[model samples]
Target: MATLNKGILGGFSGKVGTVVGANWRGLDIIRSRPKNAKRNPTEKQLEQQMKFKLAVSFLQPLKTIQSMYFGSGSGVKSRVNMAVSYTINEAIQVVVGLPELIYNKVLITRGELTSFQNAVLTTQPGGVLHLEWEDNSTQGNAAPADLVSIVCYCEELKNWEIFEGIVMRSDLMADVTLPAYCLGKTMEVYAFLNNVKQTAASTSFYLGQHLVN
Candidate 1:
């Protein structure tokens, strides 16, 4: 399978904090042409006419963490966690600023959930973020109904209401999406802000999958 590396490059090295998302790939469908049609349809044609099926494969959006600390001392005790407020189902384009957010060091890649599982991104710290499942067992698929959450702390814990808790499903993935049209062309991707800071040149936000008919 082909994969795209979305990691932060070299220009922006110090600002990027963390990232998490899935690498989903499914079979693409193709329509039967009239030239292939026949009066006496064979069993294969009959099957295709009845139902459409395709093999879909994808790596579950694994979790990841990358931290840039204040001091660089060997074995300095520092903890960082990501309080994710959103889930990404599609692509997001961020206009990163200079000095604070160096675009070069940042890269967007898939989160690796297991060892055998292939990952898209290179983690800076160590292993992937270990999220304790609500079910206790570490094996099997995570319940689709449950919300994925994380918490990141550097020095002190501030009162962050929006940072923690179930990021309401509505707040992340949408059931229906309106077409994005501009200059007589249609776009499939949608970009929005989950968290915003107007005063700073640097900030963090969340992104997720979008729906469109």
Candidate 2:
């Protein structure tokens, strides 16, 4: 009988191929020695089952080793590493939150206010709420603090309500601290972006950073 060599065994990798070879060998044994075979069909079936089961049992440890590289072995570790990389990248999202507004009817167009050319809304703490664009001259041509209007909004009794108004330029960014009081068990809290200009003015909300909690 030609023995299974190290080179041939390497190809098994503890998959279906290992059982296939064992099944073939068991069939050959039965065919070559039929006179002293098991008495019934069920016994012959059991013999075949035992052959495959023994093959699997012998390869179980090798299966564990191979699976660690390709499958579930290090899923948690890889995910943790990815989370750490994101934290190190400092890709956090920040927003200045809604501006202050006394009335709900007023609207501020993104075109009229020219300091911060772009605005991003986010859910991070201690992050910049606003940014401004400047010409290459490094000279600021912005209006006074009283001239810039920030329209703010808050939720009241399940309705969008206008809050106070503020005159601000670059110095009026507000940090929305985490709510100190928990009202009750709730799925989500509601807030609104009031007085957002409809024409040529747009604000984008997105997932900025991937961080580990």
Candidate 1 lDDT, 61-179, residue by residue in tens: 11222232111212634212121111111211223321121222222222212111111111122222222212311333222332323322111121111122233212333222122
Off by over 4 Å in 2: 1-115, 125-142, 146-158, 161-163, 177-213
lDDT of 2 by residue, 1-213 (tens): 333434664322222322322235433211222244555668546544544443333223323222322122245544223322222222222224212222222212212223343333333433212322223122233333322222222223222111222323333343333232212211111111112221121111121221111
TM-score each candidate: 0.17, 0.22
lDDT of 2 at 121: 32
Backbone clash count for every predicted candidate, in the order shown = 27, 6
